[model samples]
Target: MAFVEPGVAAVEARQADRAKIRAVAAGRRAVVIGAGLGGLAVALRLASAGWRVTVCERYGSIGGKMNQIEEGGFRFDTGPSLITMPWVFEELFEAVGERLEDHIQMVRVAPLCRYLFDDGSRLEMTVRLPDWLASIRNFEGRDAAGFLRFLSMGAAALELSRATFFERSPWERPSMADLAALRRPLPLRTVLPYATVVERSCRDPRVRQVLNRYTTYVGSDPRRTPAMLSVIPAIEMLHGGWHIRGGLYRLVRVLGALCERHEVGIRTGAHVERILTDGNRACGVGLRGGENLPADVVVMNGDAARLPRLLGQTTASAEREADRSLSGLALLFALRGKLDGWPHHQVLFSGDYSREFDDLFERRRFPSDPTVYVNVPTRTDPSMAPEGCEIVFVMANAPANDGDLWDVSMLGEARDRMLARLDRAGLMSALSGADLVAELTPRWLADSFDMPGGAIYGANSHGPRRAFLRHPNKARRVGGLYCVGGSVHPGGGTPTVLMSARITADLIGKYERI
Candidate 1:
């Protein structure tokens, strides 16, 4: 009554509530280093679990590689054009009391990806299995049995992945029961190498090339990357590849907004110079500006290849130390014409698939005949382009920046070759007078994304253990130091990175420090 003497009671009540909130925060503080998708996801997740979370990103803007390069009235998503698993993003939003659909409008890609072989053969992988199968049969003249077998292989791996590899602790090895669930051709073939799977399942070289390209999703070298990666194609076929109505940058914006709604503090341009530690236990982080922010738990959403240095250690375990994954050479073109007849995603296979892999993984040189991945986002989201114009994100799997090979001269040469290859493949005829908006080589990726050598997917799943034995979400040796993102298990891709974020959050719950 009497206006409570100009809101004196309300002020006191607010002070009391603030005291209680501070008391609760005293025991829980989390510092997420990076505002990438993984960092943003985990930051919101930790905040949802009552942790006072702070996300520090070196870049002025968030999203990391999942960003946009806007120029010449055209907008392009820099990475990950396809959304194979919408459920992952839905879960992310659901956990934060938001609906993914409310923030993002995604339309199912009718044909997930269109594949073009060296022989000018074309196959459109459609959302409907019957349609895809018909196209395959029409083009390759292959029986459904071979296709069924390949799908089965992918399904088996997917089943096992969801049950064992994805859900389990990265620090733990699979049990016999886990192996039983896999129920594959054999143990030797399942996890050992890709050669066995290729020899058995991939019969037609064109189909094989298409299937082999799936490994490149995680930046794995299909020639040496384990057969477990066969799950990728199945994921696309089963889960369905959806494209955001705007761009992936829309998701980034929504994620950042959700973090804000949850009261998670995100500071951009906060470069973590060092991860302060106390005998393998993370103490806090030292910002580049000589600022120290102490935290009870530290989640690193950075590329884990830099983990050892972040911890100020010389080396990582032989088992945990993974080889960096393949990098990419991206060509973002601003063209003055609408693109028709091209799916949202297109893969033009190389003439010599093995030689291409050899050039990328073995010789560490640009492939003479590179498998070109053309992404026309404007096809689905027309707003991405101007009137009568299209924005194209063309990519080629390239070697990681090895020995500074991607110099200006070298990149120019690679670009010329890429244009020639595109022309030869009949893809360049679509672009008679196209403007090159931007070219992001591995060198640019490494410099921009903190990805060592611009290894986009983080670690190459080479050898037997490489696929399954990636750097764990929970650092085996360090306390209060956890990792999530493309660099760590359970591997890269938008969905897998989200999975890693989920796993790291769970691991943090079970972490002894908290």
Candidate 2:
């Protein structure tokens, strides 16, 4: 199905309604910068509570990174391909008085992903507990029990996050959940980097490597990210990875419909150049066309790091670059024929995982032997491609460096490196003769989204400080200014971004009177 673009007629009607609303109280008016998932969501939420919200998107469409594109009769979800913690999505719809099941069909991805190591050994991760344990036992008898213990630790952390971390803002005073989570002594494992924890838990190098790969969910290096992030795999393995029937973009479609239903104004291609402030308070936003949108509350749904610049101050971005998360080089291909027996998701592991990360994070360059992620949504949802054809998404981590021009020479070199890694896994032959549909580099992301260096998750969750203390939902220095999205509090990923919206909306209701 084609992406559901916001109707021009509907947007103009909403814009007219917003003008009428402005003539009234003005106290309930909210201007949201960037019509990303979080921005659209919070706008819907506030509108439900009698707030007149107008979301301005720099891009021509909504959903931001959670977007879709179509080329050569193949539909490609350009952003996140997997969905975990399904309840988070359900809750968002329920909050807006809609049932998620009624709008979208979610299918559990069986044999979640296939892992291919350089040594010719393969493992299929499944949600079936018995089969998964059996695979571990067959691969490494000792690791079966070790893997369970590792998951148990992750479960504990996830449970703690549900109450304290995910539900409330970090700046909020300790609630009962926060106090309860702190009642016990902190585990020593919590302080150790995730890689160390993984090494201690899994005896097999392959198992440790797979476990370390979870750190990339938050765009962090495994050797440095805090162990609390173990919750990533725990959530995926326990709740299971899922795919929407048509495509992941279906979720964005439903969200857009809900936003429209709730009478939230959505203005696409409206670039906000500056967040107009009155002394210490945000009053509205100035669009690039010199059209100033006035409001009582302004919420930034773009990169939180860009707030300083929008507020008319410059930052020493070098510091941000040093602390930025890893970006990715994505190549979308439309293959003429399908590869039989291919799984929905697969990982081609690099021979030297540590060295690959060093190249990406420390050396600030693409890895010569990069680990590649291959996602063939057609394996599960054939509608993603034309009949008898397939769409393949290949991605590899790259340094989020502003210096890399990603010119033709650079892109060619990166593509060759990715193909080399795939060839080593003996899968390149299947992809031969495929047509490259589209490509995304860090530069494209940075330029399109205004994110610093195109760091997907804003900052790397390296040490505890970086991991726990992200950009807050409530802007510290600017009154009536709020923030949401992957870069803000509670951190990145689709589910967490929704949670940030909830927290930000709640904060606005509590602090600002309608």
**TM-score winner among the candidates?**
2
CA lDDT, every model vs. true structure: 0.78, 0.86
Candidate 1 stretches greater than 4 Å from native: 1-27, 139-143, 173-188, 314-322, 512-514
lDDT of 2: 0.86
Clashes of each: 1, 0
Candidate 2 residue-wise lDDT, 1-514, digit = tens: 1122223543353344334433443438899998888998888878866788899998888989888989878999988999888877876776667778899988889889999998999889987977887888878899989888888888888877876788778888886646876665545696789999888888988898889999998899999998888899989887788899999998888888888887888999899999999999999999997899999999999888788788888753535576998899999999999899899999999999999998988788999899999999999999988999999999999888888899999999999999998899998999888998899999988898787888999988989988988999998888999999999889999989998998888788667754
Question: What is the Cα-based TM-score of model 2?
Answer: 0.93
lDDT of 1 by residue, 251-333 (tens): 89888988998889999999998899888788899999799999888999988878777777666553222367888899999
TM-scores, all candidates, are 0.90, 0.93
Root-mean-square deviation (CA) per prediction: 8.5, 6.3
Task: Quote the positional error of residue 286 for candidate 1 in Å.
Answer: 0.3
Q: How many backbone clashes does candidate 1 have?
A: 1
